[model samples]
Target: MTLPADITERLARLALPSQAVIDGAHVDALSGETFDNVSPRDGQLLNKVAACQKEDVALAVFAARTAFEDGRWRDQGPRAKKAVLFRLAELMERDADELALLESLDVGKPISDARNVDIPLAINTCRWYAEALDKVYGEVGASPVDRLSYAVHEPLGVIGAIVPWNFPLHMAMWKVAPALAMGNSVVLKPAEESPLTALKLGALALEAGLPAGVLNVVPGFGAVTGEALALSMDVDMIAFTGSGPVGRKLMEYSARSNLKRISLELGGKSPQIVFADCPDLEAAAQAAAWGVFYNQGEVCTAASRLLVEASIKEAFVERVAEVAKGMKVGDPLDPSTQFGAMVSERQMNTALGYIAIAGSQGARRVLGGGQVLKETGGFYVEPTIFDRLQPSHALAREEVFGPVLGVMSFTTEDEAIALANDTVYGLAAGLWTSDVNRALRGARRLKAGLVWVNGWDACDITMPFGGFKQSGFGRDRSLHALHKYADLKSVSVTLR
Candidate 1:
C-alpha cells in the first residue's frame, strides 16, 4: 500500500485550522482554550484545535442573528446568493484533493472514498443548492372570490448546524448548503472528533464573497459548544446529524431556550434482506458484505443487519464472508485500502465490546473477530460477520457503528419484514429479489425512510435522506431539504 507522492507531500505540510471562524475571520476562543486533535490512524498529534465554549457560541449566535436581521445575506437577490454559493462550490472543487486528505486523516476513512465520494458529493451538494436558490418558487392558494391568497417561503434565520464525525464536511454541507441557499445565517458546530473540514469550509465561504457573520464555525466537544448552540435563544433552528441521545438533548435544549426547530438525522441500524429469488446473488453478497464494512461501518444508514431467506442462508453467508475476508484493512492514506481505522481507539473498543456481547448472546461468529493491524498503531478491526442469532440478540437490535455484520434467516416474506422492522431505527433498508411483487410488497411493509428494491444505498443527492420513528426526522437532501430552512407565510389581499 504505497501512499501517493502528492498525498505524502500534502501530509508533510498539513496545516490544520486551529481556530474557530466567526464574522468571516479566524479567531481563538474567548477563553483562549484548546484541545489536542489526535489522529486515530496512528494516534499522532494532528494539531491543537480551539475549544470554543458557551461564550464563543454566544458570539457566533449573535453574529449570525445580526447578519440575518440586517439582511446582509437574507435580503440578497436570489441570483446574488446563487453566485456566492456557486463560487464556494468552485473553490471546493479547486481544493478537492486537500479537502479529501483532511477528511481521510480526520475521520480515518479511506482516501479513495474521501477523494471519490465524500468531497465530490459535498461539492456537488453545494452546487446543487446554489443552482436551486433561484429556481424555488412559492405557491398561490385558491381563496374566496373577494380575496387573493398566496404563500411565500421565508428563510429561517440563525441556524445551529451540528454535524457528526463520520461524514464531517459532507453532513455539514447537507445543512449549510440549504440554509445558506435559503438566505439564512449559520453557526456550524462540527463534531469535536472532526472539525478541520468545517473550519476550512467557513473560510472558503468567506473567500467566495459571502458577507461577514453569515457563516461561523465553532469546534469543540458537544457538552459545551454544541449544547450552547442548541440552547441559544437567538438561534432559529438546529439541523443536527448524530446519535439519538444527543438529538434528544438538542430537543430538550430547544425547549429550555427559544423552542427552536430541531431537525435530527440520528444514526440507524438498518437492514438488508435477500430472498432466494435474488436477481444476482453475487451482487447481493457484495452489497451485504461491503455495505456494512464500508467506511468501517461508521455510516448512519449502514446495513448492519442482513436477512437471508432460510433456503439460501448458509450459502449466502459464505459468499458474504468471502467478500468480507477480501477487504483490505490498512492505512486510510493508502490507495488500495478498502477498510480503514475507527475514528478513535474508543470507537474501536466499542465495536470490540459489541462483538463480545454478540458472542455472549448466542450468535456464532462466521468471519472476523478481533482487532487487526495493531503494529501500525492504528485502530483497525477486521470485517466481522456473525450469524445464528435471534432477532432478540443485542447485536441485531443495536447500532455497533463498526465493521460488524449480523446475519439472520427468515422463512417467509412476512417474517423478514417483521424482523427488519423490529429495531427502533427506521433510516434505510434494502432487499434483493427477482420477483417484483415480493419486492414491492416487502418495500411497502418495511419500516424505513429509504428503501431499495435490488441494491443498497442506490439513491443519490436527488432523493430525500433521513429516517422514520426513533431514527429521527427531517429530510436532508434534494429540493425537500430547502424546506427545512424556511418558513411558510400566507398572505391574502382583498379585491377592491
Candidate 2:
C-alpha cells in the first residue's frame, strides 16, 4: 500500500491520545476489549480504541443519567450552560486544525473540506445554538376571565445520541451542542467505523469545563452498544443519524422502552434540477459536480439525482462529464484532493454493488464508472454518472451514498416536480433557473425539507435542517433542534 505524499506528512504530524477517558479518569474498557482504528487510505491500523460493549454503554448511560439527575450539569442555569457551550466552541476553534485532520482520517473526507468547511460549520453550529439558548422564549396564552396560561421549556433528562460514520465529529457536535445547552446530559455513541475523533471530543469537552459524566461517549458496534443505548429505560430521548432501516429500528426500540423521544435524520436521494432557463450552463454544471461528488457523495443531502430539462440535458451532462473526469480521488489527508476514499472496505463494496445493479437495470454509464487506482490499497471508486434512468429505476430511487450520479431528463415543470418527488426520501432538492416564477413554484411544489435555488448543499446554522418523509423527522443545528431536547410545561395562575 502506497501512502499519498500529503497523507504521510499529515500522519507524521498527528498527535493521538491514549484509548480511554471516563469521568476524568483514564482507563480501558470494562472488559479490557480494544478495537483498532484503521485508515481507509491504506488499510493500516491507525490506533486502538476502547472496544466498548453493552456494559460500557450501560456505564456511560448511567453516568449521563446520574449527571442529569443529580450532578452540576442539570443544576446549572441556562445562562451558565450557554456560557459553557460558547467556551467549548471557542476551544473547538482553537483546535480546529487537529480536529479537521482527525475527522478527515477517521471518516475519509477531503482534508480541505474538513478544514475549510465541516469543522468550521460544526463549530458555528455549537456557537449558534449556544447563543440561542438564552433567547428561547416561553409562550403565554390568553385565558378566560380570572385564569392565565403560560408555557415553560425544560430539558429532557438524558439524551442518547447515535451518530453515523460519515461526518462523525460534526454530527456528534450537532446533537451534543444543543442537547447540553438545553441542560440535558448526553450519552453519545459514535459509529464504530469512525470513532476516534468522537472519543477525542469527550476529552475536549472535559477540558472546556463540561462536568464529569455530563457528556459521555461509548465507541462500539451497533448491535451491542448502539442497541443498548436505544433500549435503555433510563434514557429520556434518542437522537440518531443513519440509514432509514436503522432509524426505524431505533424508533421501535424507543417506543418499547419508556417511550423515549426519538429524533431521526436519515437517508436521502435528493434531486438537483437544471432547467432550460438556467442563466449559466457552465456554472450550473460545476455546481452539479460538487453537489454529488463532494465527500465522495456520502452526504445525506447530496444531489444524487440530476433532473435536467430535455432542452439542455445533453449539453449539461457533457459539461458535467468533463468536470467528473478531473475529480481527484485519493487519500483524504491530501490537501489538494477533491474526492477521498470511502469510509471503509464494506462501504466501498456496497457502492460497487450499487453500480453493478444500476448496470444490470439498463442504465448506461456515461463516464468514469468503476474502481480507480486499485494498486493504492485504499478503497476508491470512480466518480460515476449514469444516464437514461427511469424514475422507477433503483439507481434513481435509492440512496447510493457514493459518488454515483443518476441523470434523467424532464420536459416540463410538472414533470420535473414529479421526478423530484418520486422518491420516498425527501431530505433536500435543488433547482437551477433564471425564471423567478419557476423557482418559486418549484420551491412550493417540491416535497423536500430544504430547497436550494440555483445551487445545492448550501447550509447555515441558523436554518432548521431535517426531512419531510421517510428521510426521517426533526431538525438539527438550529434553535428548532433544541425543542426536541426540551419538554414544555404549562403553568396556570388565577387572578382575582
- The TM-score leader among the candidates is 1
Pairs in clash, predicted candidate 2: none
Q: For model 1, how does the per-residue alpha-carbon lDDT over 1-496 read when each residue is reduced to its tens digit?
A: 3688987999888778889999878999999999999887888889999999999999999999999999999999988998999999999999988999899889899999999999999999999999988777898988999999999999988999999999999999999999999999999999999999999999899999999999999999999999999888899999999999999999999999999999999979899999999999999999998889999999999999999999999999999999988889889999888999999999999999999999999899999989988887888889999999888898998889999999999999898999999999999999999999998898899899999989999988899999999999999999999988999999999999
lDDT of 2 by residue, 1-496 (tens): 3556666776688876535455555567899898888878777777888877878778888788888788588778877887788888888899888888888878778889999988898888888888888877899898887899999989999999999988888899899988988889988888888887777788888888899989888877888888999999999999999999999999899888899989999999999999999988888999898889988888899889999999889989999999988888776777778898888888888889989999999999998778876787778888999999988788998888998999999999999999999999999999999999999999999999999998777778878889999999999977888888999999999998
lDDT (Cα atoms) of all candidates against the true structure: 0.93, 0.86
lDDT of 2 at 406: 95
TM-scores of all candidate predictions against the true structure: 0.99, 0.96
* Model 1 stretches with alpha carbons more than 4 Å out: none
Q: Could you tally the backbone clashes for each prediction? A: 0, 0
| Model 2 alpha-carbon drift over 4 Å, by segment | 1-10, 17-21
